[model samples]
Target: MFFNRRTPQSAARPTGRLRLGTAAVAVLGLGVLTACGGGSGCSSEAPDSTTIKDLVVDVLAEPDSLDPFYRNTAEAQRYYRLVYSSLLQWNEDGTLAPDLAAELPEVSKDRLTWTVKLREGVTFHDGSALTAADVVHTIEQAKDPENGAVWLAAMSYVESATAQGDDTVVLKLSEPYAYLDGKLAMLPIISDEDDYKPNATYATTGNGSGPYALASLKRGDALTLERNEDYYGEPMKFETITFKVVPEDASRIARLTNGDSHIVPDLPTDQVELVTKRNANAVTVESNVSRLFAYPSMKADRPTSNTDFRLAIAYAVDRQRIVDQVYSGAGRPNSTYLTYGTLHHDEDLGLAFGAEPDLAKAKEHLAASGVELDRKFNIIAVNDPQVTSAATILQSNLKDLGIESTVESQDVAGFYANLVSGDYDLILFDAPASTSTGFAPDYVNGGLNSQAANNFAKFADAEMDDLLDVALTAQGEEAQAEAWRAVQQRDVETQGNIQLVVSQSSQAWSKQLVGYEPSALLWLNTLRDVT
Candidate 1:
């Protein structure tokens, strides 16, 4: 059994529907292996026209770096979707789906070993055959600590990734990981070659078995790819795709409005009106990934260190307002830690934020603690547009109760280190979708447990621990999913992350854009421009 932060999904309802599954961590010490995703953040609804295909997405920002290993940034992975292919692909419902590697794994009784056979006839853009060697190299490069691939943390379950034969890859695990197949779906296989460096030019032009090929790329401006003619699976409809880089929020909206580009991402809620009025055609709330959890100062003496205080904050933030004002009401206000479309989502649970607009109630609690309105608190946030906006909203919400707060912004690396090092009173989630499903641990006992150093909020509880312990140790999927759902509900009840808003984005596109999966990842394969 893999020692994962994710607990098994024991209580999954047997009704298999086509809804997007939540990108949730699986039962194991490390949690489910993290996957790749396109840039920016937020969730959305399904497109009105299923017939709409052929895509030329207007990416609001270019990747900081395209080197797959060096640029584990969400923007980088978003670019990779045009070229790379991972072992498995996750379904919208959070089940184990396949992209390159076909089907789920056959696990042993103790559930430590898995045998995965490659789908035949899959070829890279460079005409290289994707075999067990390709899978091996991808895993090896990711596991290298020097590479610093965030997904590698989840791959800790592997003891060896050796080939059983020419086409079959066998992974021996230290522990049972029922969600291993789901994890592999995110690890797009890299082509095995003599001179493989993440910095090489060919790296940007991927050599995988995905639905498309990297046709052209620039360092920070744009990336383009054409459909893989040799691809062994369903053909992409779009002949080519251009990922145009536009950084300024207003500029992205303008491009979509002018029809200069299609499929823009992360349109700020304030600008949705301009986009909708101009294009008269936009997709909002069509895709989503939950941004849940809270980070805290781990020092024993701090108020944030108290589970109740953190819970109180969770209860205070109006998630619906965040979704409505920040996201333009594209998505539901989710209180459970697990995201929508997951086996663990507790549909029965309401918002994590407690009663509405009662400053007296909030002040009463603070006064009971002998805390005065003049007391100061520091909030550290990633220096990004959305983070700034959210921080501003949080400031306004907290100030009504006379809480004195100041917001500090930092670059990406600074943000991660600062939060992990326990330097922030509050931190907003800024990482991309790759870490989405694997971010939340099912219970308190898992290493990826939400209160750990990386958990940002620094919260832990005995109830959370006991519940997770039972879920992980117990057998069967139904029992596990139920326990995981219960954990999400518990977190909401406790005001865990106090998620203010799950951002929803609007992408402008001509009905010509096709093959886009229309999920958070903005999967671009199986797409083509309608002539």
Candidate 2:
């Protein structure tokens, strides 16, 4: 019964087998809790990894901040899920299920209104009962135009959030949004109390109804969490969980082999074989969701603003070469905007830029663009090893086309700053894997559309925006398919952003961890079920 509390297998990929670790735990009993108070965000140094009795997860990137209101990085969301609970959860099969909510919301016939019922008796880490007001407050904070909420664009359709009573919330929308349920899964509920408002102390602290309580934080080094003993749902397997930031791949592998860490996520494909050879009990799993793409700055004066120039950049890069050399053949070259796991993905669309490099066509587009021969370009990317390697290849490809460019490597913070400033000619970015393809609408609208807060590329096209609206408002699957296909077709034609690689996600965990399930989106929300 070591894996007794496993969640149901995703219906989307029922045939996909999960490789489970059979390593026996030396001790099954709960360990003593950490001394820090829950949700205090207390500062402390990390314990010696080799000496810790509980779980220690080795992570590559330290989250920029703990505040979900402003921090939108995948790493931040992973930490947020530990400290807070949302109304719904996205399963690996792309289905939505109730989490804090008593059940799924009842949608109106027009799909403009949603009535949500709260689960009774659920209390936050502060011992306050969760109610409809908390949900309303969270939604309002997210939808506020001036709040600078990370999810503001995702909640654009929401017109109002009002509490019907202690347990019921009514949400009104300006227009029909089929993906409303998925949006609910993104907003973590917090108390309506003013102390927890945006930019308050709550940014560094926690007051959520999740299974784990934030015990202490060492900031960029590590964070320690203790199980919320008063959790209404099934208890977390480990009494304490520590997440240590290990940026180097070698160091993370070293930690895993030496038994200093129980799990190490974001394993590079090239290092998978090395980690498995070092530890027989180490179990690794792969998921198809990490989308690597290029965002060309579409500022009016930038050379990349020219559609022909963008298409030339897209066609010149050898995607298959990047897949083989950079990813160790663990990824596929994608030509269109949508990835394999996404809904309405047309395999036969045959994008303008094929997987293989077409130097002749690239030169033709480059000639048509009439870009100055001596113009230099700037390429921005995170300091990740694979990303830098791919950027180097792109630089080489552009050089062959008589384009001069320099690759600038930056940390996560610097990367985002450069991305939003519209100063760079082109930037390489990754969209973290998601369980729900339903987020496609928000991804298109918020990340790529003109006037969007996060539209770092500055891509503006009236037609694309109209296509996004159709995709978001489409009711039936058939209608949605048509709308999304039109959107993808337009993306291919305009080259607003070039799709690069659909990489597989890899994670290695110790055999001592039982019921350790692999997530398609790498959310790791099932840790509560892992003993």
Candidate 3:
């Protein structure tokens, strides 16, 4: 799931059901791979091996919930994807592909009606067959405002869903939405037998048609999964996979080095060398996940509401220094919200602000804003090491310009509360777009558009709204890309949110792990292909 910094609220009613296009017929196949090894401390020879049965993974935090509707954080979504299969799947290259659905839905000429064909022979973990009714039920729960689905706003265009037969499901939409397929790709389909009610407690186990079945869950300590023999798709290589929650970065790295854990995700940049030095078999995998920043456009009464003041903050940030010092050279400075390879990334638009800090220009813009320099502002961020470090750096930089600012570090939940309540002058946050959906209008619309549910910045502009409309409803990809480029250009000039850097998250795994691929989307289910 995308990283949302706000709490879930009552979702607005969807205008109509969203219709999307059919996917190609190609079914992805897995291939065996040659053994490869890397890391530094020990000799290059591979470690003595034993039969691979269980694969242990270390994560920073345990999932707050197993229920798809309640699990909003990226950490939770990683586990959710393993237990529940969606109608659509995102390929590593960011293309939408068929999952439980036999083929993509067929959209009507008006682009309002969509017919989806369910795959045959797929069974839930409980041995029940998947059907159109299950799809309908899952979608209904997701679209219902009472459910408070984290991604509810993305489905606001959907109006209704109906089961045509045991094998087919139909969707009706209010308007032509080009990215509807991508939005639906993230909706994990659950079985009708599952107790998935609005605002209910997280289910201890999941009943879905995925390759993995929940074996046991231990809340914040660990959760284990076993391969489902009756899965409809390719068989999982590992019989059991356990995700262990180790919140401390040092402990996580220690587990990987000590062979207690075979894989660890989100390894801090500063720990990369330590892990390699401790274990020769540890391999570091890096993927550019998102752009990190402090959004300052939340309240008009705040000094940041002034465009010049926001620009001053943008120009004042030494992005390279942040990347070097905070990330320890693990990330690259970025100016746009979208990642480098995503569609309509606007290379030129982000470059307008320049990569390096310009203190003189920042001072000039600050002077032009006419806000009182002595006014102290609050900078809020989650108490993560990197984020807080970056916040501290930003506070010091502002102080150098005779600007008074105070840093406030909060836990994840508290930080999200501050974000939704508009309680901070500068908010340190990050928004990651899935490779499949991030290339569309959803990223910008969610973060920058005036009425977007995730628009914590409270940015509103007529031209920005118009450009987004064009991008979402445009008839062709080229036209849509062009319109989105216009949106980026507008954002760069407006400085609604200053993107400090493109963040790169590191994943370290034992060299014995094979066929594992690091993904920008952070799909932990990719482990199914590993041996």
Badly placed stretches (over 4 Å) of model 3 are: 1-50, 70-72, 121-129, 145-148, 191-207, 280-287, 364-370, 373-375, 431-441
Lowest lDDT sum, 10 consecutive residues, model 1, at 30-39
List the candidates ranked by lDDT, beginning with the highest: 2, 3, 1
Q: Please report, in order, the local distance difference test score of every candidate based on alpha carbons.
A: 0.54, 0.70, 0.67
lDDT of residue 495 for candidate 2: 72
Q: Which residue ranges in model 2 land beyond 4 Å of their true spot?
A: 1-53, 195-203, 280-286, 373-375, 435-442
Per-prediction tally of clashes: 61, 0, 7
**1-531 per-residue lDDT for model 1 (tens digits):** 111112322223333322234332222211211111221111233233344343556665566555555554456666675567777764443445666766666678887888888888877777877788888877887676555454554565677888867688888887664445555766667777735564564444556566677777875577887778887766766667678877787777777656566666565545545655563344443333435334556566566665555555555565555555555554445445555435445545634353244455555555555543335777766656666666766677677766768887666556666655666677765443324433223322322354232344545666765565555444566766677766766666555455443333444444334324344443432232222
Candidate 3 C-alpha error for residue 24, in Å: 25
Q: What is the lDDT for 111 in model 2?
A: 84
TM-scores of the candidates are 0.73, 0.86, 0.83
Candidates sorted by TM-score, best first = 2, 3, 1
Scanning candidate 3 in windows of ten residues, the lowest lDDT window is 19-28
Tell me how candidate 1 scores on lDDT. Answer: 0.54
Candidate 2: C-alpha RMSD to true structure equals 8.7
